[model samples]
Target: MAMIKTYRRDDDGVLHYREAWSEKSGVRTHMGAVGTKGRTRFHSTRSRTWPDKPTATEFLDNFTEESAADGYFPVPDDDHGWLVLQCWTFTADLSHPDDQRLFEHGQDALDEHLGWRGVGHYDGNDLGGKPPAGYDLDGTVMNLFCKVVDTGLGVKVVRSFARAFHLTPYHVIATREPGDDNDYVLAWSPRKRDKDFDLFRL
Candidate 1:
């Protein structure tokens, strides 16, 4: 696998990311917001930008340096964990049995819901079409796009789940998969789903 370099920046609460890597004959980059698939471009080794560098790796390293100087800091290599789209209910305090039971009930409800699973797709190749403002496409990250097989059942389940938890209806959370540092909410729906979720909303 080619070595990939990732970087992130925060602009007035919005998080954006960019990725660069070397290919056999070129260098590629993707830049956009944290969740959505962003735009991608390839710079062929035969281009003028490549003649000075001995290899694609060298060219990419030089490009990364320029990006860093422009305020994009490298994201830790271990940060490439999967993000999951699921239902979330509040648990005031896990140590309290009442909170535990409420949380368990929500979990059970989510697991028992029918037609809950959907076909998840990720960007494996550069795709065309304008992504909404502030979005990027990178093959290295776990950015998921879902299509529910049964939309009728899916919407009903979502509504029920929200009501059961006494949360504002018609919302869902895209959070870090079970055990990755913390249960960071990457994004949320029926609100500002296109933007990264606020990390300090505790």
Candidate 2:
């Protein structure tokens, strides 16, 4: 999945938004007033004159820096008073080599983003008979973390975060079981079969 970032600025009380993301062809950006149709442009790494940015990821990283320097700030996660969910992933089940690769890829893709929180492990045994809070059954693994930025988009952020691991939305587990809509979990398993990715209900 492509990684996206949104920036905002106010000029004389008028608000504008700018969004940038890494795409298959290169870097894409959109900018306009908050409620209007935006203008977009694409830049190819080789075709553009960005001397220091040779990769889409590098281009996006620099784009973010330049946006900040230009007085454009990241849109506030709770701008609309939405409950900002602090979400984290369970460690990937690393019994399969593919799972390890997916976990690493997701981590690397998200670690630098502003929404990324810190990662740590919970002592599953210490949770008083509760299972470890992660994808891996083993409780000792480190969890990757992120927040539900743009909660108004309703899970888009979470889905993109999961897609980085080659996992789909079905792999997401919420912090609350059954009916409660809460945080997210990225599920994984050593079993390669699709059925093994089923959401585990606590």
Model number with the top TM-score: 1
Q: RMSD, model 1, all Cα superposed?
A: 17.0
Tell me the tens digit of each residue's lDDT in model 1 across 15-73: 45566767767877777654334567977765575565446766677777877876776
Global CA lDDT computed for model 2: 0.43
Relative to the true structure, how large is the alpha-carbon lDDT of every model?
0.44, 0.43
User: How accurate locally is residue 90 in candidate 2, as Cα lDDT from 0 to 100?
Assistant: 33
Q: Name the 10 consecutive residues with the lowest summed lDDT in model 1.
A: 118-127
Instruction: Please give the distance, in angstroms, between residue 165's alpha carbon in candidate 2 and its true position after superposition.
Output: 34
lDDT of 2 by residue, 1-202 (tens): 4655554546576555566777775787877654344577978874456555468777777877887877777644444212212222232344454445545554555443213321111111111121334343432233333343333222444344455445532233222222235333323333344232112233
TM-score of structure candidate 2: 0.37
